[model samples]
Target: MKKLAVIAVLILLAMPSNGLFNFHRKAIHFNVSHEKYVPPFLFWRWNERNVVIEYFDIVRNNDSIAANITAYLAIPPSLPNQEIMDIEFEPEPDKILEDEYGQKVACYKLKLAPNESLEIGWRIQAKIYNIRYILLPFLVGDYIPPDIKEKYTRDGEMYKIHDPYIQQIVRSIAANETNLLIKAIKLHDYVIRHLSYALDNKWDDAPTVLKRGNGSCSEYCFAYIALCRAAGIPAKYKGGTYLAELPPYNDSIFHRMVLIYLPNYGWIPVDMTFDEWIFHHYAFGFHSNRFFALMTGGGASQYLNWTYNSHYESVAKLDIDSTARWLEWK
Candidate 1:
């Protein structure tokens, strides 16, 4: 396996090639499992029951298969009598599977939410054999952070003695002399070196992870997003499952990673979970279509663009049916 530092150097060296920036199509198949509950047509309850709803699954055949899948369990407030109870989205799963030669092919299942506390079960499957090639350009974009962003930025300054590691990662990318791939590798290496995988620690913002240097998939993602943005590179936080031989709950199991858009190569997946896995493929040598892409972008508050939530019990809840209302409202 290539060291994270080595990969960063190579990525830096490979920049400035117009031919390198192009999208390759892929074929994909995915299955999501979660629990969902619909209030009995006429039941009037004071609190909302937890329900897990699945979203985003569409498969189109071309040069490669591409699909984005996500699910949320939330409470909905309806009428004068409905109240939401404790709602939680736990054990979220993310994965992607590709054919041996990078051809789109696969059979896989990813757990989007835990079954133990879910009221509804959800799944999405897609297969695409033909895909087209396209170029991904570097476009400057702005992301309006949710309420959480302000909190984390403040916490980062007040709680930590100036994160030297964060500064290092930002400097590497901002130098801008290196290629996009190199910038990405440096950012990925930084996270793998500084952050420890802690699936149990639920992180709602970036500062919490920066302060602890330990967190679940969300924390890792937040760090990556923060670093990339600091470098003036446009990056997005992606969540989904990876199809591997390991069990889903194993500390060794890999969940989600950040995918950055390369000027030429559209969206490329990066797995800080196993920096070695990325290095093995991007550097050392190991290739397999065992991963899949799910949801992309950060602070899932944007999901509210399509989803709505009401307090069911003192916990977070979502009412997917209101998605129509969002569209109509827009």
Candidate 2:
């Protein structure tokens, strides 16, 4: 058990994301260009070292009859620069699921005797870094294939795609521009300039965020997503653990970014809140791989989709301790 704030409420909200990028590539379709990724000149710089994560949930049953509990948590997959190692869990999850978005999940179906307190934890080591993307501008088009766009672009209860305000904003951002990448960069810049960072007043949605002009990472990311979808770009949210909260974000680890599909690129990462860092050459891809991506989608988490039952109390949390990075979190 770490501190009170760091490792509690692991169960998280999901979100949506992107389109037009900020690059100067001419307008083009998905099939118009080949893969344009080139290794960055600086092969490697910072290694955030290894982050030990312990995800645990405490479930207390106060009822007389046996209490049934269903719990699920998101586990990140190991990617090229990002590696996952030494995974462990107690009372092993009843089952593991590979969600539609390809997230690896651990699930537990349990029966808690009356007055029993059940705790389950999953621990792992994450080798993290700043994931870099090719800096050269790539072609981003105005249209995305219907089959592809609908999956990420749909207006959900949180996205508020039907909002007239959001619709107008997206249109103004596009302004007859067909380059999806440029549009994305414009949206990124819009959020950076418009919204001042602050704790959310309520469940932050795009319209709400736009109206306030200040929000958490989720709010900024959601506002960006809403604008992208409205502009016909397929986008979705990326939820993760920021290795260490810096400057505007504070000590909170729960963080959010966006992933917009570019014409040639499969799905590139973007972080409106950290756009300045990218713009100033702080890191490539906006996401400094500094954060560990655990879940995606809207606030309705897919990680918890398998969890639901009668009266009970539950929360998800992670403990991240690191050195050299000067990071301390629970």
Candidate 3:
């Protein structure tokens, strides 16, 4: 009887409890580096112009990883009476590293373009170190509450709970018969119009922006994410490097931008502050090519959180491709 009781206790201990006892943690290390080599070119005052950009990137990691990288460039549009040029994509060299597990880690290389043919001259080389950990908390649905359990049953109001801003936005949309795309556009526009871009201010938190109505690129992104998530739009935060044209005497370092996930388009880059600044000031229209995006979302306690560091040194080399030609519009 005693032997049987001991065996039963051991079996009970082996079994997972509410799916929480079966969870595991994983550790990964990753590194990404970029370099650009651009040949000098002249700019002409035509309705449309064609230019080719070239880029090279190298990434290294101790483990396998998967991530998305975005490269932005200003391309001339093809419109009525506009000349269009075909953009080309060329392959670049990729470097790989192996781990002790003897498993070949995954690596991804992508060339994100503004349009299909107009390939921006940029290369994003990524190295990923991934380890799969079984999370027991998901087995018995221990992570979710009983009330919220029924909410996830369907994709309606029950599932979309506790977001005041989203509720308000949805109400407005329903009243006006507006679609989701239009709502996102209008919401972004509203954010841009209401907020001002001021790099001098140091606050990058969402609550700070909500109270002060001012923030930097991160704040802009946080505010945007909060509003989007509140609307049940499934939004996330993206932080990475950007290339911006610096003035001759200006010593500003690093550029930042925001990316939101669109249902049909996956992730789309939006530079609300840049667009607003250009629309209002017109003096700064060009972004740098050496800016490299590093991380996404806010919970980056493990990796280096570049967005929070106001004085982080930039590893970008800016070379002026053309002479300054300021345009004045009424």
Top TM-score model: 2
Ranking by TM-score: 2, 1, 3
lDDT by residue (1-330, candidate 1, tens digit) is 255455434543332233233233122222212212211111111111222222222222121222222433222222111112322222332322332112111122322222112223222332211111121112212332333233223322212313565666577545653455556556666677777877773454555676677777656666776676555445554443344333221112335565554432334455565554344324211112333233333333322221112112112222222110000000
Where does candidate 1 stray beyond 4 Å? Answer: 1-118, 128-169, 172-178, 244-254, 276-288, 304-330
For residues 106-162, write the lDDT of model 3, one tens digit per residue: 222433222212122232232111111111111111122333223212222212323
Between candidates 1 and 2, which one is better according to lDDT?
A: 2
What CA RMSD would candidate 3 show?
Answer: 23.8
Model 2 lDDT, residue 144, Cα: 55
Local accuracy by lDDT, each model: 0.37, 0.57, 0.35
The TM-scores of all predictions, comma-separated, are 0.43, 0.70, 0.39
* Better candidate number, 1 or 2, judged by TM-score: 2
**At residue 230, what lDDT does model 2 achieve?**
83
The clash numbers for all candidates, in the given order, read 46, 24, 17
Candidate 2 least-lDDT 10 residues: 10-19
Candidate 3 Cα outliers beyond 4 Å, as residue runs:
1-178, 246-252, 280-291, 305-330
lDDT of 3: 0.35
RMSD of 2: 11.4
77 Cα displacement, candidate 2 (Å): 1.7
